[model samples]
Target: MTNVTPRSDIVLDVQDAVKHYALRRRGLRAPRRSVHAVDGVSIRLHSGQTLGIVGESGCGKSTFGRLITGLETPTSGTIRVGAHGVPIAAAHGTGTVQAVFQDPASALDPRMTVRESIAEALGKVAGRERERRVDEALAAVGLTPEFGVRYPHELSGGQQQRVCIARAIVDRPDLILLDEAVSSLDASLQAQILHLLERLQQDTGTAYVFISHDLRAVRQVSHSVAVMYLGQVVEQAPAEAFDRGLLHPYAVALRSTEPRILDEGTEHVERIVLTGEPPSAVSPPAGCRFAPRCPIAEDHCRSVAPDLVEATSGHLVRCHKPGELTLSGVARADAEV
Candidate 1:
């Protein structure tokens, strides 16, 4: 779906967002430590688009999602929703921005029927209008009004997720944060849900922040992708980065893990095995966060930090050398690092 909205009409704008939670102390005079879940992350989303966030667990993609959806307030920075400057960190209600989490079973109340679950999200849309919207949303998610009478337990896994999607869209939100939305489902069901989301976006012009570990799903649904490392976004680029290869070492490492159905003349990229666990976010490395594990890292990489700069049109990468580091298509074992 092509969104021709004015350039000024940015649906979601997050600038230098940070979220840090203090660890519980064991002693009265113990050292104070905080986990930096999301650190200085900035992103802008347009209408009728999808920004897929991919990273390992605890990389702060979910925390970032919570910040934008207003589930949790930021420790610093601003998150604005809509061109009207309506702040999202504190004000995006269920109607303005919604979330479809991984576990559809836990998200829905077994006590409430499908209709009630969808209706609760309707907010102030009262009487006949409320009923109409619920039914319309059910239809949009490939569920009939008859299915609304059933409880969450009565429906299949895919059916329950469909109901959750219905609840999120019933209010017609400007943005939806789907945190591993379809990862819990079977592959076939995941494909169905992804297709449904795409259709819904096309029909309603709703923007989405799809967070998942599944690179295949992210690549399938995202107009653009942002790779988060530790607590910071290391690279951000258009969907073409998946095929054209990424600049940041961490981004390339993540991309290399996924198998590609190569076309004729396409090069086969070997999966780069990353050594060691990610450094603690409480005390991230002084220079590049990925330097300790970077196979191609040099002394300079370990000494200096790189700013997230525009490597090309709409592509931002945080790397001192950028493409100068022989990565992408080349193997680290053979490359002149």
Candidate 2:
């Protein structure tokens, strides 16, 4: 059986995080609208482990990443990292964590050479030591030292991403938030980056919060997986549980689109395709955000908001009928607690 033990050494804890953005008209009779970017999202990442977050575009994946890294503060709830056991609130001005954005080109300074870009992040270290750290970080991401002097424009998309990854690691942060870190890279390059990430985690033991829209990439790197819809976490479980069967409707639908991991001689399961656009986060539909699109959505889903309950060991989901929906040979492995 897969290791389902919740690692005792959790590096980051996000407890009921809620973030909302208020929209206001320019002047006069303007009513304010609040965009509910992250609504009651909770996650836990262990030291030296990768937690993959997956969702469609505008599903608050990026926003949740920002909240964890303290780039954007949560309107409610708290985020704590490595200090104690409690879920402490993440506040501004803390550099204990780092981030790598989606756009490799935009992330790097056009004028600064790769070495300089990485050095800037390690500015605290002076003289020859800082330069050596830059070299080490670049090498960690499989980039040659000679590539350091080149500007962002001179590097290929993959190379630029390597530089970005190097920049994030130069500081040797306890946690790194990678938002679509490898999405822009080619498939082969993406594999290289993913491999590098695994090695880096083993070497430095840094916790990772990896956010992506691709299930395949998430499956490759994550020890745990979280599925988001609208602004809430619909399903989260150990990677092994996801491999067995996803409990939430949204996760099952998303997984149906993922490439099958079977090596050979396995029956191919049909995909569970979902229809319709997600409801507005500002005024999300009653009950579940997925009800409007869920193939098995019922009256309970349309009327009452389902609480996030544990349906199995190391797995939590928000749905009225947690494991009632099945696909192919998949079955619910646990009951709601």
Candidate 3:
């Protein structure tokens, strides 16, 4: 793993961000209820760093990504890019924040050639300058200028994704939200893309918000990791903390299930099989959204929501019992054999 030191300048800052969608009324008589897709989520990303968000489906990971990229406005809270605050009504695809979606096929317009797609992101730089910028963007992602004339259908999955990445960075945005950017590719291809992203960050000092359900991929790419449940962050820490040990019950349980950990034969770690589906976000549990599925829940945990407290240096967790529990982490080589 490469050593990454986050700079003092915060590239992205999100505070108490919330996004809700009201469901259609049944026959216009039933009381309308809303899906709390993203509820009071707060996170920060620094320049040349990656914050990986991991959770089950419908956990608001995607919604949070949308909020950062200005694809969807927050119902409440603030999103700031660098020193400037992002407006709720800001247009997507034109901000200092850009996004590379999961499906490259759908993300790229079928009618547009690779050159046109990348050039469009350059804003008003036209004529010879625009062509030069387009070529430069393509080269940044390891693609040749010849690929400019090819359409989305003509490229492989990996090449199409590279094009999407090029488009996102052509404008030299401060931050780029990658919503499951590598999940759709094969393992080998995923590694290649991950390496490419790391190189780009090193060269351009651009930050990334990497959202994915694949914990292994998250672990591989993120400088920090945030665990979300029921549209709220349950735990967050430096990636090293996850390999050492986690404080929250939800985070510990989720990490134990990763195949990499299991294959390594880590001691003292039991496979935790959580029961019951996550409760509806429309009306989540009164306290700790994870209390319903938590194995170590207590009476206090059931009735009161836990605030995010720093249990260790830079490790934040929302749990009634923060440091009282000792969980197993990935075993070191000496301990493994």
Candidate 4:
């Protein structure tokens, strides 16, 4: 793992951001309800750092990514790229942020060649300059200039993904939102992409917001990690702390379930198996959202929502019994890269 100093300059900052969607009414008399996709989430990222966000499907990971990339507006709160506040409905050409989606084919134009697709993202640069940048981008991702003439359909899955990455970085945006950028690829390809992303960040000093369900991949690429549940961040800490132990029960439960962690053994800390499905975001519980499924829930946890409190330096957890609980983590043996 790389050692990162917390910097004062923030490439991305999100404060109390919320994105809610109202469901269609079943009848005129029926009361309208809204799904709380992202509820009061706040995060910050420094230049050249990657913040990994991990959660189950429908937990609003994608929505948050869209919010940061300016694809979707927040219902409330603020999002900033560098020192400037990002306006709702802002287009992608602002040169502050870019996004790489899970599906490379969907992100690319079927009719456009790789060179054209990359040049389009360059946004107004044309002629020799555009061609130069396109070739440079392709080379940055380990692709030859010859591949630029090929269409998306002609390339393999990994090569197409490399093209998508080249398109994203060609703009040289300050921040990049990677929404499951490696989820579609095989294990070997995923490793290659992750390494490429890390190298790009080191070379360009660009920050990244990586959203994925793969915990191991998250650990490998991120400088810090945030665990979200029911549209809220439950725990956040430096990447090293994830293996040392996480304070939030939900975070601990997640780590305990990892096959690698269990195989290496967690005899010192208890394994908590949660029951029941997560409550709907449209009708989430009044208190801590994970309380219904938490193993250490108490009376207060059921009635009052817990604010994120720093249990230790730079480690935040939204749990009523923050430091009182000792949870299993990925054993040191399994944590070896």
| TM accuracy, model 3 | 0.91
The full ranking of all candidates by lDDT, starting with the best, is 1, 4, 3, 2
Cα lDDT, model 4, residue 183:
99
Poorly placed runs, candidate 4 (over 4 Å): 1-8, 83-91, 261-271, 328-337
Pitting candidate 2 against candidate 3, the one with the higher lDDT is: 3
Tens digits of per-residue lDDT, candidate 1, 1-337, equal: 1234544657899999999988887799988889989999999999899999999998999999999889899999999875454787445563678899999999999999999999999888899998888889999999877898999999999999999999999888888999999999999999999999999999999999999988889989999999898888988999975557578878777776666788886665667778998889888888888899987888998889888999899999998877654454554333443
Candidate 3: global Cα-lDDT? 0.86
Evaluate candidate 3 by giving its C-alpha RMSD to the native, one decimal.
4.7
Whole-model alpha-carbon lDDT for candidate 1: 0.87
- Per-prediction TM-score: 0.91, 0.89, 0.91, 0.91
lDDT of each: 0.87, 0.85, 0.86, 0.86
lDDT of 3 by residue, 74-125 (tens): 9999887753444434535455788898999999999999999998888887
Give each model's clash number.
0, 0, 0, 0
